[model samples]
Target: TSNAEKELPDAFLRRCVFHFIEFPEKDLMARIVRVHHPDLDQKLLDQTLQAFYSLRDIDGLRKRPSTSELIDWIAVLRRAGIASVELEAGMPFLGALLKREQDLLVFAEA
Candidate 1:
């Protein structure tokens, strides 16, 4: 009985985490570019490249695309620029992630 009651808090917390992950379901065709602050590190950009290579080495399916994810992906896609629907869209794309402007700030650092 002690174990059973203790498990509820853990179970509830886990579900809360999962819900956060899936919330604000992405708009798959949205195009985006990330305008990092001018002082933003080249290293962060470099790290983003490393992450992209890892994804290409792993993805085995046609997948839904979100705006920020697409911007990262264009690097991996490289000179084969024709591969990006987001690039074809060509405006400075940021996804409609916000129900309000407040939503855009999640990615921004103070």
Candidate 2:
């Protein structure tokens, strides 16, 4: 649950049971996305997931977006009627996925 494991005290760490969860692969993520957005267009979902994963790959990101953020970003896109074609040019509603200013700036520069 913590991003800063080094900051925790030894006593606190000793009492905790840590389990690392790997980020979902594309197929698993697509299935997860469908659960929240069953009727979403296939092309849009594919493109969105691609962009999301690409964002996560960016180096020096202070806070990479999570599944929750991806869901939120897709929600905004759906509400805004964003088409898959638009995503090819640039990601819309990026703020939903990237909360940190530094992260956003890094993405922009990339």
Candidate 3:
């Protein structure tokens, strides 16, 4: 609407198309996780997904980790030979999830 009309240039708006999407539920998140880590065990995938949700729920994060970040983090952990997801063990790998130094520092103190 009105806000978009005023904020976006008419030329740009004419060429742009938009769609609204519902946020994916837990089961969809599980499928996304599996897609990125096909060989990951089911139990581990579930745990990883829970960790992702928990991380997103943290208060006052500068840039909360999203599903795409979760995939990258899981890949990094897998490469590091992490067989299970523990918050402490995964702490060092937050760079893959968080993009901002401020967010990393805030997360460390959490």
Candidate 4:
């Protein structure tokens, strides 16, 4: 359950069983997103997922945004009435996904 396994004591780690989960692929992610935002526009959802995966692929991100952040970012975009065209042009509500200042700068550079 811990993201920082290296920070835990060796003795503590020995007592625990680890199971790592990979990030969901696009189709799987779409289904997960629909569970949260059933009425989201398909085009917007597609664009959002594309941008989300791209962001995750960026190297040297301090804290890569996770599934929960993706959901929150999409919610903000929908509520703010952002268009899919705008999302395609550039990411909106980026702060909702990227929390670190350095990470945002890294993403901007990318």
Per-residue lDDT tens digits for candidate 3, residues 1-110, read 32422487888778878666665788998887788788887766776777777778878786777788888888887788777645445554778888888877777777
In the range 18-76, model 2's lDDT, one tens digit per residue, is 89998899999999999999999999999999999999999989888999999999999
- Model 2, residue 58: displacement in angstroms? 0.9
Candidate 1 lDDT over residue span 1-110, tens digit each: 12322455776566554322331222222211234223323443344334333333433322323344645444434433333334333312233222224433432321
The stretch of ten residues in a row with the least summed lDDT in candidate 2 is 1-10
- lDDT for residue 58 in candidate 4, whole number 0-100: 98
Backbone clashes (count) for model 2: 0
**Candidate 4 residues 1-110, lDDT tens each?**
66542588789889999888888999999999999999999999999999999899999898888999999999999889998888877887899999989998999899
What is the lDDT, from 0 to 100, of the residue 14 in candidate 1? 67
What TM-score, computed on C-alpha atoms, does each candidate reach? Answer: 0.26, 0.89, 0.77, 0.88
**Model 3's TM-score against the true structure:** 0.77
**RMSD (Å) of each candidate, 1 decimal:** 15.6, 1.7, 4.2, 1.8
Clashes of each: 1, 0, 0, 0
TM-score pick, better of 3 and 4: 4
